[model samples]
Target chain A: MDTPDTLRYTRSHEWATDPADGVVTVGITDFAQDQLGDVVFVELPKVGTKVKAGQAIAVIESVKTASDIYAPLDGEIVAVNEVLNGEPEAINAGPYEGGWLFRIEPTDPSAWNGLLEASAYEAVAQEG
Target chain B: MQRTPLYERHRDLGARLVDFAGWDMPIQYESGINQEHLAVRQDAGVFDVSHMGELRVRGAEAMAFLRYTTLNDVGRLRVGRGHYSMLPNESGGLVDDLYVYRDADDDFLVVANAGNVDTVLDALTAHAADFAVEIVDESDRWGLLALQGPAAAVRLERVAGMELTSLRKNATRDVDIGGLHVRVARTGYTGEDGFELFTAWDDTPAVWDLLIEDGALPCGLGARDTLRLEAGFPLYGHELTSTTNPLCTPFAWVVKDKPFFGRDAMWGAPCDQRLVGLKVTGRGIPRQGYTVLDADGTSVGMVTSGTLSPLTRESIAMAWIDSSLARDGTDLAVVVRAQAVPATVTTPPFYTP
Candidate 1:
């Protein structure tokens, strides 16, 4: 529901924020967190691991089910959020800020064009 | 296409609705399953259980009729008391698990799962054709609500205008709730001390509204699943089904001591697999239908119900495993998304508080 204008999203619900540096911080959208309520555990890929675009990299486990977190773009994992390992509820608390899953250096910065902008992602999320 | 009386109320509360056994029902509320589950465990939570069915059996031959149709003995049930039982088929499989409440000498109430209502009713009617008993389907005409938690007694006591100490576990009584005659049963599935109120169809909305104002948080089927699983209760479709036998499901205690329907067939039907609980030590959740393996990675069984426990903060699961490996403290593994997660084969109940 809280799709920020500066963030780009994928149909699978991962959000990517491009900083001034080449690295992009990634987390699941609020809509994604809401659908998978009360996250108890998160399986994050370790730093320095190479991931392919659209591949399953992590698992977000809620009380009811476990959902896969797909890679938004092919890249090498530069950093993983250490706070999530201790408090998985952080994903439910602030999915966009404190609940950021990982950071990566994209293979190609131009690959962001294929992702949906904020407005387009919000339209897809709102479509019943 | 089927909807309960609380359909509009759930939608207004921003519930996530899904089709559960042909009934359009709410699976979770705005507060979500974890919070709702905690509310029911710590405080009071209300659930719209109108989708469940209630069948009335009455006549001079009611007791004898039940003895022929169910696995539990109705002769042992006294007035104002109830007992949990199962109905099995000739192949030693379960038809459904239900609770029988003895209202009077010739009257009994059988509460069944929502999806098995028609099947159970038809079976009962066919079994009673040559008998003197009568079976009636009262599911649509009656609406049911479950108020569960430690604070449930406090809230319901004030509304019923009676002291709550009189009712014990598995007890029932008729009371006037907001000018409507209703039946209150002191029993629940959450393993917490609670009461289930049965009222007329038209009066349910007002009662639900009043109870919500009385500090009962609205919970849906999602919370119900987590709560019951944490309590180590077996669900109908998951832990039980027509293909699953009652003896192997670890519910043989619910079977009667005397002869009844499907008793001889299920006594020693050679159950190769037994229901056991699993505790995963990894980060991934174990889900239904996941392959379970041994140390050699040989397939031993499959998971029937799995989820992250909201109370224990662990991945808990119910699995049907080889009878030889169904012992507590035995190590096993579940293949979750191509990864083998280490787990232990424990008793059926993973948690008890």
Candidate 2:
């Protein structure tokens, strides 16, 4: 329910921070984590893997379901959150900060702005 | 979809609701499934099991009718005692597994799965043509709750205003919970000492309130599933299906040697495949329909139910596989998400204490 104004989001609930030197970190939104119940395991993308926008790049496992996390923008992964392999519940505890799944070096940094803003994402989330 | 008596109560508690067997039931609460599961194992937790069905059988020939229509010797049960039994079809399979209680002389109560209530009733009624018995569908008249864990007895006593020492294992007795009276059974699906309270349909919400007020954590079906799976109990649709013979599972003892429906076919059926527990030595959860393989990578079985234990954190599953390969400690593999994960044939229950 906490939609920070500085962040951009996807309809599927991934949040992307503002481009910092053309690199933006990606993680699922708090609403996504709440809907997922409890996080038990997470499968993160590897560093240096090229991913296209809207492509399934990661997997998140709750206790009862497995969901795919999509790439918010076409980018190459620069780093992965290896700590998630042991402590996936970080996504439930701090989805926006410590639970960030990966960092991406985007082909077009401006695409981050094209995604839904916090207010628009809030509307989308309300309907969900 | 149907709604249970405590549907609104679950919503008020901010529970995540899901459709289960045509009923709007809670899957987990705000504290999450893991916490609710551990609470039941370490302390006490109550589950809204009103979605389960109940049928009452009464007549001079009720015992005889039950003896012929289902597995387990009905004669073995004394007054106010219950035992796990299976309702088998004419084929070498099961209609549903049930808990049969001899409530009184010539009167018995059968508890069944929600989705299979009609099927169970029809199966029992079909065999009642020549007997002096009447089977009544009493599902709507009761709201069931399972209070489970090590602290369950003491907690229930605090609510019932009396000691529960009179309630022995697998026994049932009528008790006064506050000003209301209900039947309390010392039986549960979880591998814990618990009581299943059968309260009046209208009184269910009050009973739930009293139990919660007494400090029993409110649990949902997700925890109920993990607990039962860890206990190695077979679910009706997953383990005992329309064509699954009970004689081949660890619950084979439930089938008595006496004659019953599907007796000949089941007894004559081959025991080539059996239900066994599997522990994933490799990564990934081995889910239902996953193929189980032997050392040579030949498909020999399929997973029925699987999960990571909330208490023990072991990736465990119940699988039906080749009887020859079902021995404990025998190495096996399960195809999980297209990867063959190393596994071992372990005996259920996967967890205790």
Candidate 3:
């Protein structure tokens, strides 16, 4: 429900913002946070690690269950959110903005075309 | 769907509703399970557990009838005492785990889980037909609330007008609370000192308000499950199922020496898998049904119940492991998701007072 039009999303619920510096900001969508209640622990990839699109790169743990965060686009992690390691509940509070998981530098700049727009992603997420 | 008297109250509190077994229940409140769990550990918390069913057996053969139904001996229960036991089928499988309270001469009360209410009632009804006892299903007419944690005693004393030290562990007594006659038992599943209040349907709302005013926070099923799991209590469905015996779980100590159902079948039987606790050493959350392995990656067991322990700030799981690999200090691997995470076999309960 907290989808920002400026951001692009994937069917798996990761949101990425194309920040003009070639480094896209990435985090789990608000819908993902709501489904996995009360995030207690977060495991993010280290900085400078490379990952392919659709690969599971991080782990988000909640009191009820744990889920994998897939890479929305192929990129190299430039920076990781250190705050989430200690206070994972930030995802439950402000998942779209302050709860950003990591920053990525995409290998192919045009790979963003595969991502879904806000309206398109919402329809897919609402199916079930 | 089955609805308890507190269903409307939970909805009024902005609870996340879910269908649990046939009942429309609250899984969490507006404050969430983490906040409610902390409140119970530090202060006081109350849960609307009216969904759990209760059966009353009263007659000259009440004791005899109960002795033939459960695996534990009813003859050992004195007046005003309660004992935790399980009903086992003829094949040595658990029918349901329940708490039996001795109310009076030729009278007893049995409290069973919410989902197993009908199953337990049907079993008891069929068995009682051969005896001189009358079995009454009082679940629909009563409301049960569990007031747990350190401040629980203080909160209940304000309404009961009596010190709670008299109601020791596993003790039950009839008390007048706010002009309403209720049965108060000193028992809980959260590993905290608390009292379970059983009152008439109409008196539940008033009693709930009184407890809230006395500093008892309202919690839901989420906190109840996490708290009980932290206390290392075994749930009926997850730990003790129709195919799982009580002796295989960590509750073998409660299995008494008695001539009851499934006694002859399970006598001197050996269990293939034993329930033990596992603490994940790697950065992965172990979930139920995940396979556990040894250092060589050979499969040893599978996780039965797992969760993030709020009190310990660690990932812990209860699993049924091979007897040879179920010893304490044994290093194991829990296959979480797709990767295997390093885990250590530890003694249950993951946390102790």
Highest TM-score, which number?
2
The number of clashing residue pairs in model 1 is: 0
Q: Taking the tens digit of each residue's C-alpha lDDT, what string does model 2 give over B31-86?
A: 99999999999999999999999999999999999999879889999999999999
Ten-residue segment with the worst summed lDDT in candidate 2 chain B? B281-290
True contacts kept of 1: 0.87
What is the TM-score ranking, best to worst?
A: 2, 1, 3
Query: Could you arrange the candidates by lDDT from highest to lowest?
Result: 2, 1, 3
What TM-score does the first chain of candidate 1 have? 0.96
Model 3, B150-198: lDDT tens digits are 8888888887898877678999888888889888999988888898999
Native-to-model Cα distance after best TM-score fit, residue B348 in candidate 2, in Å: 0.4
TM-score: model 3 vs. ground truth: 0.92
Candidate 1 DockQ, CA atoms: 0.73
Off by over 4 Å in 3: A46-55, A74-76, A107-128
Give the candidate number with the greatest lDDT: 2
Between prediction 1 and prediction 3, the one with superior TM-score is 1
Off by over 4 Å in 1: none
lDDT of 2 at B210: 96
Residue B211 displacement in candidate 1 (angstroms):
1.6
Which lDDT value does model 3 have at A59?
90
Using DockQ as the measure, the top candidate is 2
Q: How many residue pairs clash in each candidate?
A: 0, 0, 0
Q: Estimate the TM-score of every prediction.
A: 0.96, 0.97, 0.92
| True contacts recovered per prediction | 0.87, 0.60, 0.53
